[model samples]
Target: MPLHSLQRLSPTVLLGLWRLSETPADLWPLLPRAEAYRALLPATADGKRQAQWLGGRVLIHRLLAEAAPAVAAAVQVHNDPTGRPWLDGPGAELTVSLSHSGAWVAAILARGGRAGVDIEEIRDKAQRLASKFLAPAEWAAAQAACTTAAEASTHYTLLWSAKETLYKLAAQRGIIFKTQLLLGEFEPRAAGHIPATLVLSDFETRHCICYSQPSPGYVLTYCHESPA
Candidate 1:
């Protein structure tokens, strides 16, 4: 597939996805001018990291270009002290997050609101680590909902994604994930919003959130201010 022929999803809630049909090396010329310059340093690195970084950059630029062209010019990416990527530019009002696993990349972009996103590669080990991140009630509920190990694993991964999204949002306030972050049980109900809770730091807060199973094998949770 030619890179220019890549699939583009219709825009919704300030989010977009792009599939990179070209190898990392082939993408250099396709990136926006400023991104092409930053990608050059990654090329100097050993091949593995070079490919990883380049692929992420290309996906980010493509999604930003398609979703919010006016703010794309000021879409500067910077790393927090802990190395999480964030935007710091003229369009600082935009809240954006990106996640990728395997070949696909997903990005969430919000204007005048805070947003967070996470994508995990499903695996069995997720069950083993559940105790550390999940509240006791969450653990029991997840176990009861799943009859098979795979089902249980998927449920746990979704819970983890919720906590991760909370983590990123809390980072804005300099809160720690392990201690400050908390999540409630996963109540997958047919009516109304799915029930989940979050606590950022010692303060209990209510967040209006939404999520979707955008594709098979992955879950996406997004927390942001309700549209005004």
Candidate 2:
């Protein structure tokens, strides 16, 4: 299939029902060594990235196979110096990123430029780790958005997802989220646009990033020229 078909399907719709039944070992042969490294990560902090890598590849492979025939035989996958992955064969124009927490894996793919995605389960785990990545303003907004610690946890997870997506996008530009990335207020809106800010210190620039709550209890985000 052409890349356009895959682009037309909303990431929410694609990810909403997507599930993986096979293990990384089952799909590693179809991917290159570096690609396989991602899937082979053990279920530990040190291995989480590897898991994300593997999960993203499997998710992309399944989505592409369902979306286009051209993807099946020649969906060449490659990695940047930073270790971000990309498709580089017959359908090389497709850009994708994947993140998984627990049993669920989330992926985003689009033609041209770059795409990123992340998913998190709403729980206290997010709060425990909030201070590590979230800025003070983000914590304040999250606290104001939720009345209880549990709600605060969910809010933080959403913020983390947004920041992560932005981090992946920034990686394409050789930027890092820590120190280099900053976020603004959390606008409460659904579907259309929720206000947030992303500051890239290296470039000394800030961008108004749009966030979308595409599904109940979940946050989804992306960046690219309005889908052609």
Candidate 3:
């Protein structure tokens, strides 16, 4: 029952967040195919990894219950070789993405298109590592846009989270986060929409990413691709 928030982003999209208050034992029974999912856990999996994995599936089912009631209990989560999670069985058509950071896990589902999401616990590490994932100009712009250190911290956290969401949407490997995924310059705030572009060798795609501080010390970002 640690479902922190589930919101209908639009008629076709549903977003949910789960704050971990339960252990693997508590969450095992909440999942649909409990044993199957349990088998997916690696031998090295620790308590936190188990919780994040279980919490993510539980959160997905919670969202599915609202978006596709009849299929909620039947849909299962599977991951590709690249570790991108997808829905199988009755609700196979729903494009979904899942992410976790610290004690928070998030999921986003799109009924007829693709969706991606990420959550991060705000900390100083993001600011220190900004240059690795963000372009030089992007980092400079971020510094110029924010007025205070806290805002700058939040800004960098969001930039990292936004790139993570974009990577999920791409659903492929060999992407260099710093060079390939490009986030447009923006001022930081409580919540807002920002632009991002993914540059491939032969082509590029633009995306609108939504970001917010859903809880204290945490930042969440998600993006969607319209169904064809």
Candidate 4:
């Protein structure tokens, strides 16, 4: 599939999602020449990994072309010490984040602030692994709030994706999701919005995060430093 979806979350922030339908041959011509993007692509030529990597760059290029030309031409997408993808170049001015799951790739582009985006398939692991990321109270609330098993599954994915999204945004060290990232008001749906809070360093400070479900099969969430 070509660019699956695009959203202007704010004047400075752009969100885009792409589902991979193109093979490695079709994507090679579009890949940026920068060596920085090399690691983003896997050694294996055929797989969701390569497709998602190409899809991410495609979305980044599309978003930049639509938003800013200078950023589009000179920008180099690279990873940080924490394995977080970011834009770096003389003309680069956007804070970016990328994620993929189950053949879907997601990207967030923002100016003047941080941005993080995550997409997770609504699989069965969330319910089983809830204890790894959620406190007892949060898990109880989520269970009570979900009306059905499907809803509960999505809720758990949302909870997991929400934290993953926040992790990309904060990009800090030694932050425990179970203890530091507290669950807030979550309105689960096939497609809807969610608000979350993150406590940093043993609850010394808290940051608010934003989330949304862009598609039915995946739970997508994003966060930034902006007030939005």
TM value for model 4: 0.88
**Candidate RMSDs in order:** 4.2, 5.8, 1.6, 2.6
lDDT score, residue 163, model 1? Answer: 73
Off by over 4 Å in 3: none
TM-score of each: 0.76, 0.67, 0.93, 0.88
Q: Write the per-residue lDDT of candidate 3 for residues 31-142, one digit (tens) a residue.
A: 8878777677767879998888889999999999999999999888988888888888989978999999888999999988778999999887888998789898888888
Kindly report which residue stretches of model 4 are placed more than 4 angstroms away from their true locations once superposed.
Answer: 34-40, 44-46, 202-209
Model 4, residue 178: distance off in Å is 0.5
Which window of 10 residues has the lowest lDDT sum in candidate 4? 201-210
lDDT (Cα, 0-100) at 78 in candidate 1: 58
Any idea how many clashes model 4 has? 0
lDDT of 1: 0.59
> Best to worst by lDDT, what's the order?
3, 4, 1, 2
Model 2, range 56-94, lDDT digits (tens) per residue? 665677666765566545675567676677776776766
lDDT of each: 0.59, 0.57, 0.88, 0.77
Winner on lDDT between 2 and 3 is 3
Model 1 TM-score, all chains together = 0.76
Q: List the residue pairs that clash in candidate 2.
A: 1-68, 1-69, 38-50, 38-54, 39-54
| Tens digits of lDDT, candidate 4, 1-228 | 788888898888889988888886677677566455666665765665676777788788888877787558677777677768777785366778899888789998888777789999988799889989998888888878888788878889888988888778777888888977776765655555555666764455345556666667788888776644
Please write out the lDDT profile of model 1 over residues 52-123, one tens digit for every residue: 455555666665676668767556665556655666665566666766654455566665555666666566
Best by lDDT: 3
lDDT of 4: 0.77
lDDT of 1 at 112: 59
